[model samples]
Target: MCGSGQLAVLLVLLLCALRDVAPLPDSGMLFPRESPSREVKELTGLWDFRADLSPSRDLGFQKAWYKSRLAETGPVIDMPVPASYNDITQDPMLRDFIGWVWYEREVVVPARWVADEGTRVVLRVGSAHYYSVVWVNGVKVTEHNGGHLPFEAEIGDLPQVHMMAADGRAAYEDVYTLPVGIRTVKVTSTQFLINNKPFYFHGVNKHEDSDIRGKGFDWPLIVKDFNLLKWLGANSFRTSHYPYAEEILQMCDRHGIVVIDECPGVGIKDIRSFRNASLAHHLVVMDELVRRDKNHPSVVMWSVANEPASEMPPAGLYFKTLITHTKTLDPTRPVTYVTCSNYARDKGAPYVDVLSVNSYFSWYHDPGHLELIPIQLNTQFENWYGKYQKPIIQSEYGADAVPGLHSDPPVMFTEEYQKLVLQGYHSVFDQKRKEYVIGELIWNFADFMTAQGVVRVVGNKKGIFSRQRQPKAGAFILKERYWRLANETGRLPPWTKYSCLL
Candidate 1:
């Protein structure tokens, strides 16, 4: 295995090769097709709970009381997978525990699951809230930082097939697997690795809150969110500003979406939070995240900061060190930071495996100057390409929408505006595919609530879906474009049957 020093060397080599190297992979690499032969393990179920920081939380996830309490809980508390605490807790104290949560569930590996040596089971988290450490049947499988990014843990070593002991007791009492199955199995962090290659993350930023739910979400509702993005042709997703539920990540893994696991580090614009933020605290948060979701196969990158432009020098150094530390903890995937600096060349852009930039060009600038926006974007990409030689993913790019306002030929800001901007973006994207630019994810999948209050009708209606799960005209425009771009098949999948907006 490559050590930390080796990884650092690799990063340096990337920097050294920037100016002259051609692009790595073809931009035409389509969204990965589903694997019919693979069987996924579902870890969704009731989790035993306690919030007072009791010692029992540390007894590990296998304690009898914990299991019994979780199983016996009524209504199963309706804690949806791929959701957040914001959806569950109404208590003041519980509401702010955004960085920590203990999740427990019982899973039985079917007797036929490990029939083949190459088959494996994975426990994946779409996005962790802030920090998390995941344990499977008491085995520490994976952990991750970054609440918005996806992460997973490998449960291959865990028995895939289970049955009652010879005494016919608990269904999980005994486990069996082919001896060769162990060779392909592992217990590790879910750093992103697609087709055994490090895939650059490309997708939109997401928020957990909907104006309707006010932070509440159920499984069916959550699946709607996925369908909205999937049909729009997004292969990757970023849980902007906070950790999302594991339910989302599990779906992403099964559905073949790359995830950028993010931390709840946004909104640090205030000086007080910046000063109070400690590397140790951030490390603790990130450590938990890395521990819990590292085994997921869909998570491709770990993002530590977003829009830290205000703290340029110090924040830049902080991000570099954090990325370095992340590689130390788990080096399978890449590290990145989304910069709001608008400059084609960001201060810390060189440190990441992929360069991510957020630009409002045509949206905030001149919508009439649509042609010029892509040019400006390309110029910026060129500057970074000249310096980093790393794959570039337009992390954030989209205009705000009011829903139901699209024009046929497409106009800017109207439902047509999304289609217009996408048209411009794809125009440039196609041109640069040969230069190694990967792909683009529209800024958001759904309109969501933000504390910013800068919104007009509601807070940040950039999503293709309105805050109430209503499909906007932009959703349709985006869906057509996304499908054309990714070459996806038929209607929304099983998880997204209720909402076909994508």
Candidate 2:
């Protein structure tokens, strides 16, 4: 058993052979098999919508409101699809509404596009907030939980409506099947494999957070973030606490950025919440997550939960059930839950395919003691490998560095301090590469807004780049580190040349 001090010294010594790595290969098509011969319709027009304010129950879903043309209702109004329901109205109640809201639109399929054995009608939604269910001509087609990405249902042979003379009533019949796609992601005992090649995650953890959107889908923000990721030499990112807008994932697929598709299972701390309602809801979220993202090649893995209470015995069972169900949904990808708990003590660690542990060594644990990070991180990695014998990814690790803050010899929140902290962590990462440690994704790609509190000046300032997507001084340090790692790991393409920032 290596002590903490010995481990730190070993990591420092291993850093002597420091070297370079790059962007991942193109993630291929998000929704593949599209061509000029196929008819693709944009469902971006106004749709009849209403909010269920009963508060006691999900009246819209429960009453099967999708069966009815919502225009027949009195409170219905035309709300735009592919936009957040929050900002579409001036009403504060509607903007802040947390419960069920119904959206309905009538889509007319071109007669020429529908033919027996030759045509397929796939209804692809860009994104919907929270939970959404769809219907076409009084028939419920599909239901999904996540708000960030797109979900599609193949509504085969649009509903046939006929009048029944006996009762003077109309009847409808519709048949549909889910789309089938290929799965190419695999995980070995040593590394994460994509299409059977060892793919290192050179990336960051990000949130779908920005100004005014409040988790709403925004295309400009998506483009900007992708550009930033490219510039930073990062080719991957975890969706952090939840799934992002489908458009973003589509962009990732186009750009070759691998994604760890995570669910919105954040803040699940209490044991009571862990058991009855939360566990059931978690499974639903998992089903929806896989249904929406399983087709995308960029989505390499599923992160079911973020920072859950994994040490608890109940949490072990809770995550075990969730992971087991997730595998059933999409076995092509590995499933993991991001844990902030100690790896040696965490009961939930055994249930996941990969061990993703979040550690804040010098920053959160021994604040300002950067020297202790190497040994401490080494011991933790060794202990986890000893027990589980699984590949590990340092999923979240960073110091909160406010832009422009500076100090000689490095102090907390300064750019210098952030650089040093990352250096320390990277040193251990280099040493542990020979061991089971597989990847390192920093806490954030860029700074983002969090709830207002005394601890946060504006929001979480741990990003290598500012919220506006501008790089801090620490960004250069990471760029070099990532570029070097990519080169060393043979991830860099032959066409690219290595250059240093002077």
Best by TM-score: 2
Tens digits of per-residue lDDT for model 2, 19-134: 11111111212353335444456656677777777765356556656556665543887775546566667897876566666666555544434433344566666556555556
Against the correct fold, how does model 1 do in TM-score? Answer: 0.60
Model 2 lDDT on a 0 to 1 scale: 0.72
- Every candidate's lDDT: 0.56, 0.72
Q: Which ten contiguous residues of candidate 2 have the minimum total lDDT?
A: 8-17
lDDT (Cα, tens digit) per residue for candidate 1, span 242-357? 55665666677777677788876666555444442455556655665676557666676777777765334565566676778888877876777777774543556656777667
After superposing candidate 1 on the true structure, give the runs of residues whose Cα lies further than 4 Å from its correct spot: 1-193, 196-203, 270-277, 342-345, 366-368, 406-412, 452-454, 487-502
Worst 10 residues of 1 by lDDT: 8-17
After superposition, the stretches of candidate 2 with alpha carbons farther than 4 Å from their true spots are 1-38, 45-125, 132-146, 149-189, 194-197, 493-502
> Alpha carbon lDDT of residue 317, candidate 1?
60
- Give the deviation of candidate 1 from the true structure as CA RMSD: 14.2
Each model's TM-score?
0.60, 0.72
